[model samples]
Target: MDVKRWLEGVQPRPATATFIAEALSRKAGVKFSLEDVGMGGVITPATLELGLEYTAAAPKVGSQLLGLTRRDLAEDPLAVEATVVPSAWTQPLLTWLLSRPEPLPAGNGIQVNVGDSDIRAVRMTTQLFMKLDFQFGGGHARAALAQYYVRDVSPLLEGKFTEAVGRELFSAAAEVAQLLGWTAYDLGRHGLAQRYMIQALRLAQAAGDRMLGGRLLGNMSHQANYLGSFQQSIQLARAAQEGSKGIASSTTMASFLAMEARAHAGNGDDRACSYAFREAEKIFDSRNIGDDPEWISYFDEAELAGEGAHCFRDLRKPLIAQEFAGHCLELTDPFYARTLSFIRLVQAATYVHQSEPCQAVALATEAIEIAGSLKSKRYLRYVSDLCTDLAEYRETHDVGRFLEMVATKYPAL
Candidate 1:
């Protein structure tokens, strides 16, 4: 019978439908219970064209559904043996299918089936983004993705997926959030960026993806370090290091450890900082440095060395920091302007710390020139540090000339 005819045939007793609904909700996945809507589900409102209002999500306890009576299902309201498929039915598939401009023609597809709270959300999330990555045509696409995929796709990764699947998915989702967080951070939306990174961390945890969690923590630590929260940054970075110990990507793991060292330097924990850096350096000695997870493949030896330089500068080891900094300066790409600018500022600071004020000013001047064309407040902050450090040198006309030029050149920095 049509839904209208079926509804008309079934009559409710003088009570609310609440009892049945609550029972059904509690037993949403059950089969053989009146709760098993897959037996013959139906919907109200007479508008839904989809088949079945609900489906069997799980076998009922003792093989019996709670709300249904065997007799008079079509003849009686309580026995109406028909299930009402929830509005949530196949919604995930429909959403996924629609998101694509060209879904595979009806032969076969790779869409993960939602099976009774058994879908591993993280793995599906990674696959969704990776499959579509071909659309971006990578010269250099930032890996930050929207929260829709994180929140929606995560539902697919809830249950007992394989360990490898969990690891891969969580790692990808975390990377997406980290990259997006970085962009948002660069754009100055501190609060929104924090939310995404934190959520990324939670998803990583759910997927048992410790390294992914570590990466998320590292992302947060970097932001904290930038904001001058040296103590907080160190704490977060330490947590990242601990979480990433056994992951496939030693290089990325090592970089996180190095970032922790940098934070410790900010906190003036020189011994702690040095030890961490040494540990990070040892990871590079492994033969398979290049065989890490794709998300962290960018953390080459040079990048680690550059970061080590920053850590050393924090530790007051000027000579070591400068050695690495000089190497990084030669190897860096122009597109990586912000990191290069940061390295330059640190070099200038190193000079200042060493009390070579003239050399400091010279190096700072050069850094300012490079920063002149960039639009990062972070870059400007470094320039301002140079100016502040050199405030005592206002005696010279060159200082006045420099300040005037800085005012014109970095007004928005």
Candidate 2:
């Protein structure tokens, strides 16, 4: 947490034993015992080579999260790996370090040589902390943090950490990928989000977050539903519930179950949807609010109603769907804003299903504003569905105008 140590010109390297192993330590179970590893230790351009080896050799490897434990074929035995993800300025920093190398007696501490290898390592390590923030917090803040660090602090690192330091940095890069996936998910960018989420899942697997891995499955399930892969979504959700049964938050568990209900609704199984909804509701009712992690924290009485509305709408039960949709509020948090729009879009779909385009257009118009703010294509897809529903009500002038407006905005329409 002492980010200051990274801010250079300050010497007298900290004691070795106290060092945190960023990504590797998370896997190592205990903090790394950084006994001063002296000469002849060749560093790589990618710290992952070392981290992966460390992961593969650990005693409880396969029993752990990541299926990948060993280093890949691309790794070099003698070459020290660093990060490419860091900014260009960091390269000069290593040049400076490598140019002024001195033995400088590291009696009781680990000595970090100034070199490309070390600077790259520090960049990777910093990203790891950024990832930790994302796992605990939400995406907007995490993305903001990642952008800030990658652009700002990254320049100063200049890759001058020891192999131990490089390993630490690589861990951070994996963690960032994990968080980026979550951030993308919360933003409604289904396709791009999926890429980030899968990579994040992989990284967490490597980082040994069994709980995070399960959560990743839960996220994948949500994306599956958005893409109409409902069956796949349900299976993934169930997998998450089973995988992290003992460790995940009750809210997270319940949210996965709720997503499964949506999958059931997508498949037109009202019975299954109802069943899952009941279970999710029971869990939500029992828990105290604000205890849930922010990832699923958006699911509350109002949001659950909106979700139910979607299920009922999908199942063609307009009356029931409208009942739930009526209860959902107008939320505005940047992350939840798009979701709120989706809920309204679903509600609009329900109205359209019932042949009520006036209400559908009205709700959709509001939802469109929220969607327009997002860089997501899913919103446009939902709107396209809305326009399809609106064709049924083209007689009215206002409806015609709104339809025209949507048409103008999306030439694809």
Candidate 3:
């Protein structure tokens, strides 16, 4: 039956009719199962392992990407609820280190022709989504991005285009895929995020974009650190630096080094973290933004400062963490609520470490207020961590009030 017939309450319901109900549920913000929509029978969920491999071949990369995107569109439960497998990071990191960029596959006799204009439009749309992600957090437009990828960008990959156009198109697709992974990570969907990042790395390799590929590895390292896979995170960061050594711009390289520093801090390696931070700062000092790719434009002074703040916080350097956090707050754009909230939490944690509960409460309250508008699970986790840090001073009046406020606002925590 046609979709219109289903909407019009047709008598016979097809076995595949659940998709319509799923779409309606998402749109109306109301739960609708197959039974609720008058469609019966179970729909098997997509497997969690569908897109985890880092395929050495370009064609397989495309296939994996398609599979993952389709699963996302179908709203499979596993896509959102799958648990993180830290062991999955091992194979992808090894594959990236051992493999080189593969040549673009020839078109399969499709008559469709993709041009520069098509590539430009894809890039513009990607930029708009990226801006929304930075300003409003990843939960805002992730589904819309997935839909756009399936509807528009997927076909261009199979269509005929010149070598130049193909490279640009693949690069654009990689950006979108990376953003998808980032949004998933922000939502605390680590399994989905890992799959997207792995596919994105392959796409970047297909585009012969070593710089972007390195950045993707850095992203993996960041996620690994978040998951407490600190050793894997450090290894991935080193792989990113080694893989893109000669070609990466100063800003890109600095970002990679900072990721290394972050992983080191997570592992409690103070000396190694300090060395990496010094190198990142030196490289960033000499950077000329004009020479960098537009994708790396977000790694300015504020970003570097924020990274430092995170590193110091992890390394237990409370005073230095406060200094870096303060700098980051001063320089960050107000539109980036997520970033601001994270920095505020870092600053508040530093105060807790310094035995200043009142000051910590003030900063943490500000952070909570800023983050209240976001739909980020990661931010909530950060808030919970700060509250844990403040436990030693829970008897104090300010700390008690702060705990009450948090319990009132976020009973789940």
Best by TM-score: 3
Off by over 4 Å in 2: 1-175, 182-192, 206-208, 289-291, 330-335, 370-372
- Taking all chains together, each candidate's TM-score versus the true structure is 0.59, 0.59, 0.87
Compare the candidates by lDDT and give the number of the best one: 3
Ranking by TM-score: 3, 1, 2
Find the number of clashing residue pairs for candidate 3.
0
lDDT (10s digit) by residue, model 2, range 1-413:
34454333222233321333334467666554222222112222232222223122222221121211111111222211222121221222222112221221111223334445544654455455444432333333544544543443233223344544333333343344445545544444333344444444443444344455566676667667776777777877777766666656666667777888988999889899999999988877777555554344555677778778888988999989888877775432445565667777888888888877888889888887765545444566778887877886788876898889888888865
How good is model 3 by TM-score? Answer: 0.87
Q: lDDT tens string, model 3, 362-396?
A: 99899988876687888889889998998888899
What residue runs in model 1 are displaced by over 4 Å at the alpha carbon? 1-171
All candidates' lDDT scores? 0.54, 0.54, 0.84
